[model samples]
Target: MSRQTFLEPFNAKAMSYAEVARTFVPSTKFTQLAGAWNSVLVGPRGGGKTTLFKMLSVEGQEAWTGAAAEPYKQTVAYTGVYVPSDIAWGTMLESLIEAGQDETVGILFSEAAFVTHVLLSVAIGIDRHVALNPVLRLEPGAETATDEPTQADLERVIATIARLWKVQPVSLSPASLVDALRERLLNIKRDTRLRAKLKLTDTPTQEYLGIDMLESASQALQAFDAAYRRPHHRWCLLLDEFEVAPMHLQKTVLAAMRASGAQKLLLKVALAPCGPDLLYDQQGSAPPSQNNDVQQVQLWYADKTEAIEFCQQVFLSRSSIYPALAGKMPSEVFGTSAYAVVDDSEDAAQIDLFTLTGRNKKQVTEQFQALAEKDPTFQEFLRRKQIDVSRELGMQPSDRHGNTLRKIAPLVAFRNAYKGKSVGKKRGVKPFNTAYSGWESIAAISEGNPRWLIGLITRIMSNNDQVQFPVPTPQQTAGVQWNCQRYAEMLQSVANEQFGSIKTSTPIYDVLSKIGDYFHNRLVTATFVEDPPMSFVVDERVSDDVEHALRIAVNHGAIVCYQIAADVGGFPTLRGLRFRLTYLLAPVFKLPMRKSKSVSLSTILEAKPETPTSQDDPTANPAGQLIQGDLWAN
Candidate 1:
């Protein structure tokens, strides 16, 4: 298969149910989501939300085979019904609801239609489960039966559900039952539009709209369980890409899920990190509070330790498919990073002292002496920390606790060592001021995003006909930069589409451009300031336009948001938010792929915007050389 196939793995929605399950590598969040409770899975676009949801669905579970899936299969406590949505469907529904002659009538019709849609999914999920009965059984304590549903039993169950839902099926089988619900939903949509066109305020729904969908769906599930001889089974409604649904419909679903006491019902919803503000009621009732009502599961990993582990797990699981990659670990292909030594599947490698300091003890001492002479800050830092680079670099430390070498040595060394080094005059000959190599660096750039991690590795493999183990550092840097540049350009394109035409001094692109330059300046300044500011705290006094643009930047993954402070209850509040450029764009700005000191968003915005510096400007930066057109156009 083509290497391009590996890139497609990042898109879970595009894959078949079997492929999704087969390729999925279970993460820590899986345990949290597998519980028989309600949850809202929030993450960036390419994070593993859809993949997890799909794996929980009946089809994915059934298609799943082999030892890797055994533990997860055993965790199945409820039958999952996956309800997928898109922008087109959501916009259409929103328009239909808005066109209603009467607000109340429109809401009722939309609510009923939503319920019918869920029911159709539920029936199909149960039908698939029934087909596997008698032959395939789930882990112990699941709602599996020794015998499959007989024709009479199936007919009776279908009749019970149809009666409960106030619908009629032309035939009695489960497939027909699913068709019946589908038709009812379609009819409701049609009647709603017709009512709007005719300016009729009377209720448009032909069937009863007063029934509680949550309770009614629960009742239908029970009927199936009873007929199949698997009583008291629970069902989870898996709503994927939920942010696409109209605001009113989203609230309706949330309200229903919160209000209903249906013991058999569970809920799992997935949406973007900046999805529409969830409100159970426009009036006074409390919104669904995390921990109190639903578990808020975030798919992205910000912590470096956890991020690398997850990246390695995904690499191992997916790489096995290719014969050439069999039994190989990430370190073998990507090699060790210069910034930090990350634990790999193969035995951990020792950090190379020569890379950070010099070729020998005498050279290392002279390098540090030269840096301390030019930079007083480095002199003070060395004295304050009692760091003896000569001894530390040339020999083992007497006390490991006092040795900051493990952490600060590489960063400090790179800052001073690469000072004043010009970008090589020849294209592709002179190297970057800093290296973005090693598995650790790759993980940092991937930003705990599985799709990104996969894409970076795939691009590297594709660039080489047969990649050698422990691929060259320059090759890794090339792959990393190639992906980073593409991402930067993609973000710029999205910015143009979102805020380009808006008459503003700081379009989203400008904000990004300004911030990128500010960070780049910190990295290449004449003075060495260890732990330069990379993160930013948004000030409340910013203009509405600027604030909106920043929010868009976050939603598009141009920047990442961190909750620095929280309420007394430890929940995230608006005041607690912090923002930083995604590390995936680190190479573009020639900044370190690490989070450090934070400055205020207002600070960067308030600074007089200079033309982007030579090293950082996409117009001139080697990283941005591939970019065409005026990316920084006013």
Candidate 2:
């Protein structure tokens, strides 16, 4: 048999038994979330929010918990149900709010409309589960729920749903009942002609439907006996992509979870760090405290160490299921260094094309030396840079450039390597190579996102329809880069082009472009400035439109934020927070990807172009300080 390539069995989509167990690496946050049972899981897209939810879902997949949260298994207690976001379905809701309806009534009406939608999703999920698994226990003794549930079972489900509205039956089947409610919910959200139907049902005892409806649905899950593990069995709602849902819905859902009255129900929601929208309630009177009603857990990587461990663990776990690689370490199968980067260099990418196109250090150095000896043009440029450096240091230019060129040949060779030979004409040329490797580079390339990281690695292993053990070979790197680059480009496009009439895009694009330009030519290059503005800060008090724009930028991963008071040297003057254009856009600009240099928004807005002060008065502030004149003397 051939050597093993550690292939990942699961993507975001399908999963088999062995694949699930082999690829699962438990995280601390997931454990805490499972133990706490009610939480808001927040992070950027591909930060493993959806994957975590998928693993934790209670769909006859017990012990689905990862290793980190072990010994404390995600209890077979909660009947965990996954609810997908329907931003498509939210349009009608948005229209209603804009129709000049009373804000208070609109909020209430929207609550009913949204709650009904959640309930319907849950019912259909449960219905399908029981329908497919006929031998599974649904309730008391009925384990025979086939593709078609018995009318008696249907009656029970109907009664359970009736308890949700707290009213008489609607005489609809499980499918019909869901279809009926979905139609009305849509009507309430968008149909101006049916605008009168926005209010709570008059037949339901004049009761206004709220999250209690979801609570009732949670309680109803117990009817499927498989959902029950022991007494005090719990039910959880895994709310994914909570950020994209309307702002009010995010607040409303959290508040609803607080008032759910289903003490056993857990709230597992995913969120993004868009500050203002999450800072306060609808009344704007109070901010939601993290420790109080709902626990907030972030899934973003804090550092390279953690990111590498995660990536390594994932590789090992996925490899374990491969028959040929059953008990091998990741390093044994795939060497730790897939990337060829300079060690301890401030700029790793300063290497030559020979080093870039798939050559190890020894081979790259030999090639560079051969080129330097053969090519007069290569020698000339090296000598020119040498003379410049020699003059700067006031040193004699006898052999400094000559010595420098050979010692760090790759660094200088890149600018003129083409003069020596047609690189690919030599037969068997290697593809691109990066300067760094291991988890940090992988994490950097992934922009600290797990989904793309996982997908990229999976694609690498699956190259040539063979298990790509030892290494993915240079051919697979392009495919891997393509996916990462695609995600990065998507974020920029959203920030730039404003897909889907999202208004927040342009402001973010404008601010980032403005910041990028100023930094490249001004702040970073200015020699006399101390504590130069590194990133722009946005005050919380900014207009709602600006806040909305910033929220979109952050939520969509176009910008990464540093919370005021939380970060060292945080925005002292700005009441809100600061943001930097996400380094994920580094590839698009062909610039070295580095963390943003922070500057305050106030600084950017208030800045006046400096007028040069001549040597006549070198002490004058370039800002043109105002002179204080004595008014009494005048």
Candidate 1 C-alpha lDDT tens digits along 1-634: 4656654435888889988877678878887887777887876678788889999988888888998888888888888898886444353345565665555565666667667777888888877876666334355566644476565677778888889988888987777888888888778767766776766765444765766678788888888888776787788999887766666777766765565434788888886665455533458866666646777786755455667788888888888877777788888777666564321111223344223444444554566666666656567778876766556453234444223454454555445554544331112224352357877788778887888888888877776666577877667778888888898887766642231122234567678877877766555443344455666666675675676566566656677765411111112223325667888877787666654556666666765543223322222122221221111111
Number of the predicted model whose TM-score against the real structure is largest: 1
**Minimal lDDT window, size 10, model 2:** 625-634
**Model 1 TM-score on a 0 to 1 scale:** 0.82
Which 10 successive residues of model 1 have the least lDDT summed? 625-634
Which lDDT value does model 2 have at 546? Answer: 56
Q: RMSD, each candidate, Å?
A: 8.3, 11.5
Candidate 2 lands at a TM-score of 0.62
> What lDDT tens digits, residue by residue, belong to model 2 across residues 235-310?
6777777666665676656666565434656677776554323544366544344556656666654443455557
TM-score of each: 0.82, 0.62
Residue 63 in candidate 2, Cα distance off native in Å: 8.3
How many pairs of residues collide in model 1? Answer: 3
